[model samples]
Target: MKPNAAATAAALHYTIVPKDLAGHIFEVTLQIAAPAADGQVVSLPAWIPGSYLVRDFARHIVQIRASSGGKKLALKKLDKHSWQAAPCRAELTLTYQVYAWDLSVRAAHLDASHAFFNGSSVFLRAHGQEDQAHVLEILRPANVAGKSWRVATSLPELKAKRYGFGSYVAADYDELIDHPVECGDFLLATFEAHGVPHDFVINGKVPNLDIDRIVADLKPICEAQIALFEPRTKTAPMQRYVFMTMVVGDGYGGLEHRASTALICNRNDLPLTHQSEMSDGYRSFLGLCSHEYFHTWNVKRIKPAVFVDYDLRLENYTSLLWVFEGFTSYYDDLMLVRSGVIDEAAYFKLLAKTINTVTRGSGRFKQTVAESSFDAWTKYYRQDENSPNAIVSYYTKGSLVALALDLLLRTESAGKKSLDDVMRALWQKYGRDFYTRSTARQGLGEHEIAALIQGATGVDVARFLAKYVYGTADVPLAQLYAGFGMALDGAQASKASLGVKASRDAGDCKLAYVYEGRAAHLAGLSAQDVLIAINGLRVTAADVADGLHSAVGRYRIGETVELHAFRRDELLVVRAKLQADDMPALSFTVLEQAALLRPSWKKTTRR
Candidate 1:
């Protein structure tokens, strides 16, 4: 396609009108100049970035019509996803209406109440013209007042009553399509810290939020992020950053970007009332805020080489999601501790919860962190009933791996080296210095990570990664903890065990493994028979432990108990002798409490 200076100007003049009402219908009219060539096609994307599935965005488009110079032009459906313009050289106006009832974050929706648009769902992706700049002039319904219309976008808002894009260029179409825009009567707030401006574009009503307190609480999070980049780059990339959010209506998630993030959260998630002080939700929300903000360095800039330039049409597989997302997940809470927003005890509680949840899942035995990261597109993103049985979460496993690695590095170097050093090294080498040059666009390679560890800690991490990360073997936590002069004190837990190594199977959860002399074995419970009820409570293996807790030693040793179960779909009853299973359990303790085992600014807890 040749550069058409005039066409570029015409593209900027495009406008959209919203006739939102009680009915689930909204129309879009695209004003385009028809080229001389026939069979030129306009198409919608099958999927958007951040979301790793092919959701045909064009399916929602109904009743498409094309006209030229006030005269109806013949249009044909060239394919299921595209429409062709007739042979003519005239001003072409294309119009279409979409079914907007599903009020999801990924698609478009409009009703008498409100409207939501995820860019790719409503805006036509003008092919061949991506090189040129375009502007969107929104014409709100006449009955709608300015107060009834608010706009949200990651793109800087132009003062000319329109949103403009100067050469819609990115590493790939994935980045381009992921940018979104929202319109409605929503609240907006602005705050600044560390000389960087921030915007909070809230869609819908405002909660009883205390603006000053919220900002004050966020200062540390923002400062920690600023500090992370300052030593490496000395400056923030953009003068202004935005957070386009949908406040509180049954959905919550965020998609990160270079200068902004699009988030969907519940209004209750935002602390506005005194009741918020009593709930843990506020802390979780702050953790979320810190997590995404930290991404400004970890992921948005220092990304995996595979993700540096995305392939929007398919999965971009990499064995580093644990490094990217898992590390981020670990830091989300750690940032709270480092930022003074959360205490050390609270941080450990979060870690303990993470361990309990991740370790309890049987998938850890089936998938390694490296494999989990690589298979995110197929297994992680598209979760199913068999997910727990066959897959470990990279986010969960990777964070644990990061924790182990951090402890290993710190102890090996006598507290002289830490994960922070590794992050700073990467930031300095790749994010700050290398990302600016054209030649540097090749992106960070695997060797870069290996080299950083050797230079920073003088430790050979290759074998550790190859074994624990790349293979489906249980992580050597005992060895890693020993390095930190600590030992897992679960010797008591394993002593008391039920006959069952409770686990889910074939989507139909049940206790699959039973050991002889265990309490469950003495209780007359056997393997391969469908576990119908435990202590008269009908539940899966996940619920049996909780049921046991409420028993209060009701089923003691030598007590005859009624065990109801199903054998191959046939319900049966049996009696068995109940006895306690003696097994040692796992817990955390310091082998030799070190005085230096504390955060940079925190008081020492060593005795």
Candidate 2:
């Protein structure tokens, strides 16, 4: 477990500067203390961890060259993302310019206002010396516009002060890229959760930003998650944490990191100083934060076995995303209620919405959650028009699976056990001290979950896993809810539907998706078909608001109508018999008398 003396001494040195803010370019220099005797290969990662897609980050390099002892060394492109430098005994220096225009969390982005980048998008890996200590020096931009810019990253400081640009250090290459850097004159707030300091940094402007309310609401959520993993100690895994968010006009996404998270949210989602009521947007933003915060323990550490050692050059596939993402989805909302941020009524509404989303898509009938998790790289990420008909989402359906498993665990164990126990067990065995321990890190295996569940909760879930996870059977939510002092109800739509999702596109009713075997699909309607009219009545873009609600809702079930639509340039007329909406409108109601006896259904006070 002792550190290698040579590797420790010969740290990989890197320097990055915002060379041209107007042109959105970053100049990066890598200094290898000792070059290999044979040709030393250097390459940028093809993808970032947490995000499953292979993004081929090297394509962003505008130009790259190598040098040793002030003389140019030969650099040859070996592959799409790798380059080989001629053997040199002197310290090898590789300089490159990265085009950082991507405005997402996964890649680098730069402009006059701000600069942000993931290390994966800017730093190239020195192949043979990846395990060596890595030091990063962030140089201030020469332009006057960046004079006030401040650096924000979770990377441990070497010569740099917190939030000030100078130098940072990482134990190895993996640790180097795990922390993303954000440089801007951003708004900042600080809060303490169970003795750990957490920073909330906002990059964009808001009219009357309410920093106190956000910190108050998020503090409990963070503390609850910490307690969930380490209930007895109530200790967080990180020394310090950061919530680095970029506020935009309209955006909502987050990618988790070990001690920090990169997030993007709508500016309107932030609370105003005068605003006292919780808006849906604000609740959603809080939920987003909770979701990513939970990942500090879940996927970020208790990872799938394959993710333990990531091969950034290609997709690292795993069939347990359901457990990682789906369970996180289930807990994201639940934590809101547990932290006293939202009430039971609001929690139930969110739960119902998730159920509706899963049931509305017919893809669940064809594909299981396991298959959905396995094919996430190809099917989930690269979805198209037929996605609703072909693939299921491990996120939505996996949450349902987690819900069902939790309910079943509580029921079978006579309320003595729950999914919380299993999660804590996973943390104890796989997550807790994952980074601090000197032994080889082990991730959760593909087929080890069922056994772990039984061992932790004393409940056999083989049949449950087989039916819902491996097989395409829907979770028996109604039956599960009945036992938990709740009633699940669905309202059947009375009006006839084309079973097509439509949107207003260019002053016309554009059919976005026609569900398979539905009235529209049976009438030969396809996606992207422009609906012209129905029964001699003109259909405009207004009629398609909320998915053809006005145009199609007027007709009753079993009614026949003449539909005219354009499949590209060809006009088609077809008489179709409308069918009742198959989409489930689900809701849950708490049975008062029965709920009194159920501890699982009862709400608890915030710690």
Candidate 3:
């Protein structure tokens, strides 16, 4: 079929104005050049892509009304998120008020200091005209009473200057919603990666930030990724990119888009002025950057079949998160080493941390990563205290799966092939130009993963998936490491175990997690148990460290100690025995001769 030239010519126009600062409201006006012959059905999405929770974004809509030719048209409620214009053939204009208060990447947030919003939260899809061009006019906040504001987004500016408040355009509705907007007096910087421009904008109160260090660390990682997928051309998929971040006191997460990613990091995670050393917090932030940047090719382009045409009204299920998300997890840190941000020793330590985290979780034996991905809507995203005992993280376990597969390929082919080959193949076959054709766009199936790996490296991994991904068998990390001349310390860090992890809450030492069949579990101790004393001595939240050691340090292994605790107003003395610590195995070190075979930043190749 040929393109609908007339429909595509008439664009859907939207104007977003920050109306109220204190009340946290944004006024949105959507105008269409033509309405449907019968009636136009307009609705807000239940949830956005990248974040898989049905958030019911339409609930934030406080009021709505429709009109044509300056005359009011009856608006009937079709459903929770849907609204219909009553038999209107004239051009439709819908004006709605949205209450924006959530402060996460998933939804919209507006305050006196700044404003940010995803299109899903403010722009209602013009039901029949989603394929047509969409125009957005971002109006300056009518309520702001502070410093001058600028805009930051990946959306193409039509009539506005770069980072200016004016008209912007998208090819279609999908592209329109994918570009999230931020308006504030933000700290901004620019850098070049493989000749494509990139922006780093942070909206927070961090003083004397080391922007040069972040740029220095991020440039090579971005260039490495650009070269990874397109080795011959070294071309990034996007014409330009942006990394919009919000720095808070204690926050960490990211959501990937086609041309940009929205991220939140703790202020301390950023390198301070004159700080040359890479702190753990800064390393973790860099890892987050790598993780989301890797998603540019994985989930955003090489998507699962189910996500190709997302149904925002309900849940979209897929069992191959271990491939998309898991593979990205594996490469997130690997890119750090490949880009020379960290040394081999540091990389090994990071790998060991992931290994110990996966193996220590009892949920690995109970739920496979495939099952976890499929049930992410109710299980993974909405987790409670029992989450650790019942479910495994697809991100952590998926990285293990990728590591095992990479090692297996390298070992089988004498380091001639690896997971890189598989990813590049997937990108060339499925992701490249995926969004160019809306009709019959291809996506990876559950079975195609195995076929691709076999074709790339001439190694079969059907049995591996059966036992580890779909089945709940643990991947033998130590055994696999031993083959590569690496030694894993399987010993626990200590011989003391309470079987319960504790944290401070309101100056009280409360149990955070109580494992099943452990010392705390067998002793009638539960989560949120506040410790009052041990062996008749008082203990507070701060004293748990020295207090716990002094309480059990005097006893030998298998000796019992009287534990006095408060379980929600019920005081009881329980006898708990000293047991071995369940701390994760650590200290993975490379042996002498095998160190020669380890890949380094300079050794990364297309093989």
Q: lDDT tens string, model 1, 1-607?
A: 1124564455523455556556656687766664437545677766665555667778888788888889988888866667788877877777887667655556776755456666567666555554344555555554545345755555534343332322232332333454566666766667776778777766766557655555667777776767755744446655567767666666677766666676676666676745435246667777777777777777777877876766543567787888878888887888777677776556666776676667655677878888887788789888764466578888878888788778777777767777777777767666764335666454457446667776877877887777778876666666777755566554423222344555555534355655455555656666666666655766554455553333324455556556676667887776666545432244566555422234442236533
Worst 10 residues of 2 by lDDT: 592-601
Candidate 2 per-residue C-alpha lDDT over 197-289 given as tens digits, one digit per residue, 9 for 90 to 100: 999988988989998899999999999899888888999999999999998998999999998999999999999999999999999999999
**Candidate 1 lDDT:** 0.63
Alpha carbon lDDT of residue 308, candidate 2?
A: 90
Of the pair 2 and 3, which is ahead by lDDT?
2
Worst 10 residues of 1 by lDDT: 163-172
lDDT of 3: 0.85
Per-residue error at 276 for model 2, in Å?
1.4
Where does candidate 2 stray beyond 4 Å? 1-9, 593-607
Question: Candidate 2: lDDT over CA atoms?
Answer: 0.90
lDDT of 3 by residue, 1-607 (tens): 2124464458888999888888999999999878887888899999999888899999999999999989999999999999989877678899999999988888899998889999988899879788888889998986435348999999988888888999888888988899999999998889999999999889999888998889889999999899889888998988888999998999999989998999999999999988888998999999999999899899999999899888888999998888888889999998898788987788888988898788776888899999999988999999877777889989999998998888788777777887888999999888988877556888998678888889988999999988999999988777777777778786644556677767777778887788776777888888888887777877665566553555555666677778999989999899988776665767777773342223421233323
**Order of the predicted models by TM-score, top scorer first:** 2, 3, 1
Model 3 misplacement above 4 A? 1-9, 143-147, 544-555, 592-607
Relative to the unseen true structure, what is the C-alpha lDDT of residue 114 in candidate 1, on a scale of 0 to 100?
55
